[model samples]
Target: MSGTARTIEFDQPGGPEVLQWRTRPLAAPQAGEVLIEQSAIGVNYIDIQHRSGRYPIASFPSSLGIEASGHVLAVGDGVSDFRVGDRVAYIHLPIGAYTTHRILPAARVVPVPEGVPLDWAGVTLNRALTAQYLVNDSFPVGPAHVVLVHAAAGGVGQLLAQWATHRGARVIGTVGSAEKIALARAAGCHEVLISSDPGWVAACRALTAGEGVHAVFDGIGGAMFEQSLLALRPNGVLASYGTPAGPIPPFDIFRLNQLGSLHITSPSIFTFNKTTEALRARSADVFAQALAGVLRTDTPRLYGFDQAREAHADLAARRTTGSIGLSAR
Candidate 1:
């Protein structure tokens, strides 16, 4: 059955002010799809990019957000994996999660475990999946490796720090302020330093006894891109994941040759979770750790669904920590 639900959307690309709360008639699940009643939504930096036109919108009146956790209200024909009343969570493209109800492709939805909180699922699903690939596939962090993670108190950063430390790697992290130092340290960083310190890059080397880190996981792009390269040792890997500060400008490729023959990679979750099977596997790895009491996910800053604009502003300003999640209206 179709129903009218309140949602957030933007008629044009602009700031948080451009977002408007409107009611839309949600259609019943189509083939290979399911209708969901959201319990929580993720507030991310990419949502800001979409709201501000930093990332091009395919059309006007575009709804933002891609991560949410909720219950399955209905499932389309031929859908056997799930039924009404199953708790589920999802994070993927084709946006429009800034609402209480939505219809999404069944392939994108995954069952949330019994013990995991829905709000935590909403915010950390994508970030945990991201950390999975970043730590396991991107560079395969493990024992004997010393890694440097930028913005180590942020959503994905905390997960990466904890997971890498679990794998026996020594984690050295950089945060923007002293307030986040202890947070990163609690997340399992052997050492945490303020990024603004002029000697921070040298500090990373100092932590590693002048050898530098084996890998530098950088999501704070733009100005930090070059510093990440400098923080890596000879034959080290530099993985650039996201550009919250701003996108990285073009640079000389020969600089890699001079910078200790460093290996650099740019990874996107869409590329990593390209298949349903792959997505499910990563989700299992994340929740399993959560159930085992190894990985942490209880640190989200909660906001009501109507407060998405405020959420965007806070996230963009770096005024929030851990994860940011929006509860359903």
Candidate 2:
């Protein structure tokens, strides 16, 4: 492994301008860790939230990536199940996914299958694993269910839509622009609506025969959180996983009782991957799904490591669709 690598660091929390691409020293693996020469880094909306101080756990001068996939260069003491030359990918809290090389806990890194491409491995874990839990555990979907996914063209949205459809559930999706409608529809949304339009919720109710869906997956919190409640059937779930529109407004818990006994839940990847065994079990399911052709790894928008700021800007402005990647050059 090279003694030095390039990483994006920030001194203070702000907009995309805060990110700096510079050469930094690569860290050697400590006990029970491994140094991965990164291949593709996943750029997520949560990264933007962390950089802007909305989610303030990140300290200054921090490396800014949540997950990546690459080849293992060195293994620290007592490391097993992984070796010096294994292709692996990992995701977790303690950010540092955005670099040419990274030293991560060996137990968190899972080896990629022979048929799966390395670049795809890096991009799949964070999004795909979340999708896996959302489908399998978070208010499980099946043939009798009708589901609604907000931002249906997003990285997580696409996977959820496809998985729901493959399970014989009718899926409805909402996107911000007209261009995204077709892509969401193609991704398995039986019906797609433009969220920016005033009548989007009305469209949802219409699609469900005015009774609303069995469950509503809402990641674009704020106003959408309330709107999602109106679009849910009695006893339906409103899965609020993100707050991209802004923090949700204060409301009465009785509002849920008033709105057909709706349920609201805010979930994060770290909670699902709380234990190494839990993480491996989820990753194994994701890998199995991808290998079985339920999830597509191709079509990710790849960007270079130096273009990190531009990548964030594009994501924040919704200028790009599907997944965005940072290639370690």
Candidate 3:
């Protein structure tokens, strides 16, 4: 391992501009930990939220990021699942991935299989794994179910649409404008509608022949939360997984009651894969699908490690498609 690595850290939380590189000393792995030489570092809205202080957990001179793909450079005591030179990808809390090297718990790391590229594996986890739980377990989508996914053109949204379609469920998707309609449709949205359509909700109702959808998988958590509720059938589920349009403002709990006795949940991927065994299994499942070509992220948007700020800006502007990551070099 190198004596020092180029790392990104900021004393205060704010915009992407707050991120800058510094030569930080690299430490060896501790027990059950593996020191990784990072290759593809990922950037997501969650990283933006952390960088902007929306969650406010980072301390002075703090690090940020939790997704990346790399090769194990060293293994500390008790780490038997990995050895030097094994390619792996990992995601976890307490950020440290905005760097060329990282040290993380072996339990949180999973091997990258033969067919999936390291960059693809790096960008796939946050979206693919989230999609996995959303379809397979969150509300247990099936053939008979009709669902709506907000921001359907997004990496996660596309994956959700693709997987839900494969499950025999009919997928309806929401996008901000007409230009994105085709993108969503390509991702398996049986029908796509502009969220701004005067009768978008009515359109959903009409699409389902007034029966409404079985569930609404929403990541644009804010106004979309309420709109999503409207698109669901009685006893429908609304999974509020993100807040790109800003955090959902406080609202009445009885709103659900008023809206057809609906069920709403804001589940996190972390909670879904809390157990090491569960994480490994879910990771493997998503990885297998990627290798099988069921999930599409053929060419990820590439960014230099120093261009982190630009990357965040592009994401915040909604100008990105497919998986996006920073190259360690």
Best of the candidates, TM-score: 1
Winner by lDDT = 1
Better model by TM-score, 1 or 2?
1
Assess candidate 1 and give its TM-score to the true structure: 0.98
Tens-digit per-residue lDDT, 1-329, candidate 2? 34798888888899999998778877778899999988999998889988998878536788787888899999998998898889899996688788888898888888888878778878767888888888877879999999999889998899899889988999999999998999899889998989988888888898888899999888888988888899999999988887889889998999999988888888878889888899988888888878888787675788888889899999899887777889885
* List of clashing residue pairs for candidate 2: 65-97
Per-residue C-alpha lDDT of model 3 across residues 74-153, encoded as one tens digit per residue:
99999999999998998889887899989999999999988888898886688889999998877899999999988888
Candidate 3 regions exceeding 4 Å error are: none
Query: What is candidate 3's CA lDDT for residue 261?
Result: 92
Candidate 2 C-alpha error for residue 82, in Å = 0.5
Query: Where in model 2 is the C-alpha error above 4 Å?
Result: none
lDDT of 1 at 285: 89
For each candidate, give its TM-score against the true structure.
Answer: 0.98, 0.97, 0.97
Backbone clashes in candidate 1 total: 0
In what order do the candidates fall by lDDT, top score first?
Answer: 1, 3, 2
Error in Å for residue 202 of model 1: 0.9
Please, what is the whole-model Cα lDDT of each candidate in the order they appear? Answer: 0.90, 0.86, 0.88
lDDT (10s digit) by residue, model 1, range 41-145: 998888988889999999988989989999999999878899999999999798999998989889989999999988899888888888989999889998999
